[model samples]
Target: MSAFNLETCARSNILALEPYRCARDDYKDDGTNILLDANENAYGPSLTTAAASSASSATTSSGPEIDFLGLHRYPDPHQRGLKRLLCNLRNTHHHTDKKITPDNLFVGVGSDEAIDSLMRCFCVPGRDRILVCPPTYGMYSVSAQVNDVGLVKIPLLPAPSFALDVANIKQALSNEPNIKLAYLCSPGNPTGAPLAKEDIRQLLEHPTWNGVVIVDEAYIDFSPEGSSLAEWVAEWPNLAIMQTSSKGFGMAGIRLGSLFASAPIARLLNSMKSPYNITSPTSALAMYAFSPDGLAVMHANREKIVAQRERLIRELPKIKGIGRLRGGIESNFLLYELLNKVGQPDNVTALAVYERLAENRGVVVRFRGKEHGCLGCLRITVGTETEVTRFLESVGETLAEVNGHDIVVYSDEEKREVEANAVIS
Candidate 1:
């Protein structure tokens, strides 16, 4: 008994920090099937091939609708075709040689793997740390903590306008030389807002900072055309831009995330990663997704989602207890606060509404009130036209019941855990 201590066995930081939980982990009630939890695409992939093949069954008479020849064999260790498409689409080419080769990119299972890999490759577990802009993405901090790497959290400036403080970040970077990775989520999770190009440039060009600046453009397609810093990575060797097929391409299940960086870093990540990380089916899907016809479907889906997001912004404010929206309407989601009769942000009221809507109404959105700068907030994904309408109606009903009523007493640890869950994957 005297020799048994879990705390002594595990690292101190690991014991102190909580593990990351996916949405499906905690909430598995019947109505929670309507999942907007993990910021997944409600609209499925640029399913041009799938559609043209058949609607009747998963398999076709000719063969399976999906490519299944190499089910027994290991998949591509280097997902070259996927990388080539991503590189071509983003136009990450050198001035002299206009071809963006597969060597310039590394594919991850999702952006989650890319994030974890960055920490692993750069930060030495107990000694080093990473910088994160909070009320942004949770995965950066979660990934750091998992690797036993410390975190320097500089939260984005508060709501209505959750902009980055470039000056503050630069100072932090200068002071914290141990910081090797800085994570910035453009069109940030829980906010749907993008960081300014000027602000990012300032951080990149900072003299004191030699660390990698990760501009996560997971939601970039929903944003303006020139907003992405992906192409600039060729010049800025220290810059690594992460984009996903999940968000804009509408293929969350495929789990193909693109990390475009300098040749050295890409090679380093490739070296560190497991051989055959991507499966054959995912590769086949990626092929169709990046093909000309598939891209058109994605473009069409993006346009529709953009329109729906705009409609949500317009209508959400009209519902009682749903106060002024907090984030920019750049991505396919809206971050807005739940209000009291007095019109201030109220977490108790917010959580109650969230719980009620999920338990009773079958509409599941993210309770972002726990996130910094998103007080009393809920992050609703931009679903199809009808789905958004259903969410709006559900919120209206739930608001009427839950508003101005605060009963449950949450422990301090419980509150922190709830807030901590605000981190997107």
Candidate 2:
């Protein structure tokens, strides 16, 4: 096996590029404000105490005082405090012997920024390529297109499991040395299953593939315990993991995404990122999210989501036109087939049901009929108890309206068979 070399992996021009420097780079904001440098509003933010107080309860702060007044000032460019809190959070969650430090972390606008940054940092436009498994996240391909970077697609091993094609990925890596990054979506989007750890390990331990393997763990917290590969970053310098506060922390509005990588890779991303990319409000909310109280709420909410997911598993199949649930039940959403009269996956019926539910009944769910191996599929997120009930009712009504028949509740034996087939298929 060859040693992982950042020099070989990164673009030649990026290695030589000098990052843009701002006034904050010269003098760090340490709260001693005799500030007349950045041309920020000295009068403070144009917000009332009443307005701030009303929204203060949304954060995990002990008191009602939010730092909304400081919005005029530029946020921390380095995000020192937030990174420290994130490091602590991951260390505690993963229980790694080697603790992560601020240097090993990169905070971006969202996972999208990190995703694009990784491409820009390594792949040369039009010359280098990245590998992705289909029936996966779309942003990877979108980012690749936006960056003008080439892409090589290896579709996930057919439906139901959607596991990574590890052998083929390694083969691609070996054959195409220009492929600098491979994006793996665990608890995959559209396909709720996770890639096996040993499968990922095979790619990481490949003798010739020196490019970075990025694991997007956007839904890891929703998965079973010990499912995250974050702790392994300490061991593999070429490994980078993308996590977001959107799914588990319930802070999607914050637009904060994290990248856990070796210190060098983290530092590289930090250098290239726009200064003040993360705003003050986003930082404050994220900090509170990491607080003890915030964590408790997150966990409690997660349990509710998991329970609701189980409810979805049990209830969705009982509906007349809903076929076997595809993919593993590790993420917040489920992907299942929309069956026709003959009980086979049918896209026409799926589209009719999806459109009717949204346009007529005011219930919205994604119609994923076009994605690889996801024929006649609808990706439904597990909502609150009330929301789930509404969805179930709406879906039944929509299916009956589309099919022009009364909804038939499946027998217990039929439901069991469908569920069992979902598990094994």
Candidate 3:
């Protein structure tokens, strides 16, 4: 047997694609750790603080004491306990008459694993495709490309401020007829708009389309009440909801993502995913995070973060070059454009300001300039009170320094034309 060329063995689609670069990849440590780039909870959801400080407390006072000495063993392959806890939480908060069970849930190492596994189960390479909306989560497309799954991108409604294009989606499904999965990011990445319930209901009711609708509600905790479609999965077999503890529960380090779907879909995903993928510690932390005290902490954190988000919405426009604050008032992040001296979407300035804030001042926000309907825009994660204040000061300084460059004025026609062909790269 001859030695195989790894490159030759690699899938054709993946060979040409660039790997998804996470927030830490872009800016490692800016000394201040004012990391607003990744939509992470700057304030963590740990319940151990009370036990850590009080010297008079009993040894068992700390809730859900994790077995650190059990590192030699593997995690629970079935993850029944975690699933049951999640089921109870959903039943309580989702306000649905129907009950969700452990059988209806599938756990993964972040929603990325769930997304990838679903593609593996549903899509056929080269023959089948997935429908995606532009300026949504990068991972959906990246995962599709890696899985050699085709993409039918339907741009979001422009005039309505980046709402889901339900009309075009139906049209795409009609034409393609091979789209197996539809990835809808509610509280959409880079565009904090929550998907309209009626619009999603229409998609679920699309008579001709037989594909599953995977609604990524990773940021739904920050969204309004009744915004999430997780509960609807019980009624609609084809609807799958991807939720995460990373954003609201502050369990990013634990790497636990959830998929709430019909029992069959959940089973299929569980069957296809790697055995023992989630570790013991991660499972323990997640289970504890959903416990009574932990849930209380999560709610407290949401209130404070939402307050800061409102403060930013009220104050960020006061900065000189920030043109228009886009996206709905939802999620832990905001997307707003950076303008030039003559009042144009200045991609150059946005990029420069992002770099300046990250490299020089230790403040980091994402430059979403090239995303659809997000021209000359930056996506900033809502941080704690002190972090938000520091961000305002540093970002204001950077914008002031970068605002005076010669700008290219685009005609409305040209703007429309260029923006129409929105590319993720």
Mark the 10 consecutive residues where model 3 has the least summed lDDT.
1-10
* lDDT per residue (tens digit) for residues 306-417 in model 3: 9999888766665667667777767898887887777687899899989999999998899998988788898899999999999988887777778753323334675454
- Candidate 2 segments whose C-alpha is farther than 4 A from its true place: 48-69, 92-96, 411-425
What's model 2's lDDT at 332?
91
**Candidates, ranked, lDDT:** 2, 3, 1
Residue pairs clashing in model 2 are none
lDDT of candidate 2 over 1-425, digit per residue (tens)? 44469988887777777877878778876667467888987655667766655565554353333345357788888888999988877774453568778999899988989999999999988888999999889999999999899999999998787999887888899897589999999989989888888888788888887699999999999987767777678878989999999999988988999999999898889888888899988998899899898989999999999889988887877888888788878889999888887778989999999999999988899999999999999999999999999999999878877777775666788767765666522
| Candidate 1 lDDT for residue 103 | 77
| lDDT of every predicted structure (CA atoms) | 0.75, 0.85, 0.76
Q: What TM-score, to 2 decimals, does candidate 3 have?
A: 0.79
Candidate 1 per-residue lDDT, tens place, 1-425, comes to: 01212333223443344434345545642433665655534443335555634631444353333323334334556666678788778773422234446777989899889998877777778988888888988888888889999989888987766889887898898897578888999888877878887788788787766578898999998887756677777766778889898999999998988898877678777776776678878988988999999989999999999888877765665565666677688888888788775767789888988899889988888888878888888888899999988888888778777754342323466545544433221
Clash list (residue pairs), candidate 3: none
Worst 10 residues of 1 by lDDT: 1-10
In candidate 1, residue 71 scores what lDDT? 48
| Model 2 residue 246 distance off true place after TM-score fit, in angstroms | 0.9
